[model samples]
Target: MTSLSPAPLISLTWTDHVTGTEGYLVVDRLVRGVSSGGLRMREGCSLAEVAGLARGMSMKEALHFDADNPGARYIPLGGAKGGIDCDPRAPGAYGVLVRFLRAMRPYVEHVWTTGEDLGLSQDLVDRAATEAGLVSTVQAAYPLLDDETGARRRLAEAFAVTVDGIGLDELVGGCGVAESALAAMDRAGVPHGGARVSLQGFGTMGGATARFLSRAGLTVVAVADVEGTIGNPAGLDVEALLAARDAHGTVDRGALRHGDRELPADAWLAADAEVLVPAAVSYAVNTVNQAAIKARWVVEAANMPVLPEAESLLAGRGVTVLPDVVVNSGTNAWWWWTLFGDIGPDAEEAFAHTRRSMRALTDRVLERAAADGCTPRTAAHALVADRLPVMAERFGWYR
Candidate 1:
């Protein structure tokens, strides 16, 4: 008799058109016991991309569960992602957003709990959940806002500890790009002391990156959001920019005095800078824009921020591109450790282990890439693939 194989997790897609724009909800992998993911809103988001992200989340969780902590005894939580292909910048965007959320209400009630993602805010999520009456007992059991803030703080703290343990300084808050850029610069020997930095996207990641880079002695020459680009060759004050930034991450126009110009959204890519970090959406650095990038190094803090073709193009131009999987895995791994607590009684020690592991992984990948003249992305994949089988065998996943 043949042994029964486990059922493959289900992926669901739903689409709706409202206010003359289309929206999609893609559920990637649903662990039968617990499930979670986020919603992404942008003009070009597709079901395929959302589905792929969900699957990645699943793999992320699986790896965390299996290797990070062995005795957590926690069942798998399925992963899901939703995307809406509506420009959040347009008029009536909020209305379409509400409709999109309403359409996915049933899923939110039963098997999924969605949080903020690209172009989506926590306020919007709370509004949608409240409107749909899908707020869970867990959410209702505590002081709503306090619970969210507390959890986020704890997660952020854990992330900081993990990074510090790895021998890297704590990430200067901004987006993932700031952290990734720091890592890339450290590896590439780019001097931060007098480097001029330009950033596209001022959201949590971008804004944080600017502030951190500035504090670290890098001169932030330009910053751009969906609204426009602001520049000052003498270096913009990150603190002033942060104060002027609105909730959507756009800097207030009235607060600038310098070489600021109202340029196209993509203009930030061409700005003169020693380092350019894209902490915005995926595919921002595609074929068309690849030729325009002026930075000596491009560090992607967002998932798949550069298309493969763009990466090839940049590589040919002698640009060093730091892959997201390695750069941001530190944050992902920390979250998993927090959720499962598999590191034994000493959370500090466990976090230290995570940091050491992350730094070691980065060093190994960089060393291999240099030795073989390969891209960091390729080296990362090769490293992971080689180690995974051994990990599986040790975990008893195979006899």
Candidate 2:
């Protein structure tokens, strides 16, 4: 069922002259001479981790391919990812980022189209890209686009659009995650009004997911950030805490009410809830900590958040894990949809597309899981296995 190679198509490591920090780029695949992924900056980011993320992106893109649908303008591209081994909060981190981008400029200009990932923001990446003398982070895609100017304009407008003070770009991905959770709950005969959820990380992805799930009538019982976990049995005021977040996505502890309890950093793993979302970092849930989870479902809102061994353990315990390739793919798909004219700059249209696509995909994965008696991750990989050959037949294996 494993379709992708263990080794990536191309791998490069760069050492920054300013900080001597390492950066990595792994192109998992390429379609039409272009590949898409995000640039993540974090401490201890290894080439192996970047390679895993790159492969995950390949699956994420392949999962969305629909050739028979005439209205589907978004043709999923191949996967690539970049990472830097430095803390974004550390001194001279920006310098390292600029230098890293400068070194990766050739790929960005030719083959790789990237945006922000963990420990970095799109705005920060855009600024760094500008300083690196690059036209845009996604400029490589311009050549493949039919009307690059119009697509660029539409994307910019979409990025500028906001709903209730949250950017449209940020909400679409979370909307997909929330819908996947809802679809699973519906399949399991659980009511949204009664489901209690706990999540780690309050950044753009996690915060937006909390907003949508809260609006959908789910009680967000706990949320964790760098400092610690904030929990309330009665459900914390999601809006108030959202308003109190800093640029780095950490919620201001001073904003907590009397009912909100600041717990230990790992408290979210053991919180009394029906659903758990590890939206923070890679390998957040390992075999040892998997025993602490009592939730019926663990939805990965972060890439590679759950290790394979941990996932196997959770599956043995009757806990279903919705894989990251399926759960967190909305934002990437949304970008392509808008750029390729499948969707527009309007928030409502974007949300509708994301919901429809994510719900259908989730249902398909879950149904296959049930029929095959396998994990959702296995089912998802099987689905990808069935499609990659077709895409390769049409587009060819090598770009």
Candidate 3:
């Protein structure tokens, strides 16, 4: 892990009187006078977390755009994230969301274009935008229909294209997690069907990755949700677990029939698996449990999933880790397509392009790491950061 670096460019906080809650907006960097990100509202969300996420988002932009294609017009927006603390299910959540958006009108209009995250849903974003007089047409929350299946059905009726399945693959970041993980396994000489995987945080990101990895023939030996971890020496049934997941992406422990043993909350770390994915939250694989992780690869499917010291420890122990910026980038690619693609007739081409872009970049990072004798995280940091000085020089933004 590297030493600490420069702090964020701006950090703003305010209290929304309507919700009686605090809101934080952290701008990690400003590229070309713009920074765009989501407005998440998970319980216990904090300013530091928002800043860290903004930093990650910034790195994602750095890694995605470069000299060859440049794509300067739309490729890299500055990195920022906004968040609030409040129960999304509260009866007055809409009022709180409206007030929160209104309070941040200046930032939203001039600094960042924010979307939904965590507890912030599509309906809430739309309602808030209308009430706050901000344009609601562009806010993004996946499967916006609450019922993805229904949305697909409606799309099929309106458009002549084929829309298949519930289409969680529409969730770009989750798809990226599986793609990067599989690519990492392939680099390690683990064949497509040969790797065994374990995952923590069986929510949207984790669950989507599990479905993808399992479909691609990986053995998911252990998975843990908020309550506890479950394991089986042989692979667990990904289909069953997905079917059992709650609306919030949790799988009830009571629904398990195949997992041979139910372990403590942290036992997922000790699973006899080849790949470990911490998809739940930050500080999950830290000093306390870092020593116990047995996986050959730790793919961070969540932003800021590993602390610096733990990442260093894992590297010292010869466990390779594909950083979150690489493994958790599918959604970023998806968003680019969503905003820019001409889905009328070239939709298939658009998706194909997204997948290829995600894979090519991930492969580039992995290869560079192999040659440089550093962790993927380190290699990715250098590879992406090297571009900034040039960008700053040309853009005249950094002093």
Report lDDT (CA) for all predictions: 0.62, 0.92, 0.71
The prediction achieving the highest TM-score against the true structure is 2
Error of 3 at 232 (Å): 2.9
The number of clashing residue pairs in each candidate reads 7, 0, 3
Candidate 1 per-residue lDDT, tens place, 1-399, comes to: 011113324445455554556666554444443445667788888867776666545444443333454455333344556778877777876777677777777666665656666786656666766665665312321221234555544444543443312211123224234545655677878777888888887876677677767867899887888787777778887778777877678888888876656677777788788788777788788988889988887766566678999999999998878776565444445433443443432345653555454556567667878988899878765665554444444432212
Poorly placed runs, candidate 2 (over 4 Å): 1-3, 397-399
Write model 3 residue lDDT over 246-347, tens digit each, in one string: 755667666677545787888889888888999877778887789998889899987788899998999999888889888876665455444433222233
The better candidate by TM-score, 2 or 3, is: 2
Full candidate order by lDDT, most accurate first: 2, 3, 1
Clashing pairs in 1: 31-78, 34-77, 173-208, 174-205, 174-208, 174-209, 175-205
* TM-score for each of the candidates: 0.73, 0.98, 0.84
Arrange candidates by TM-score, descending. 2, 3, 1
Q: Is candidate 2 or candidate 3 better by lDDT?
A: 2
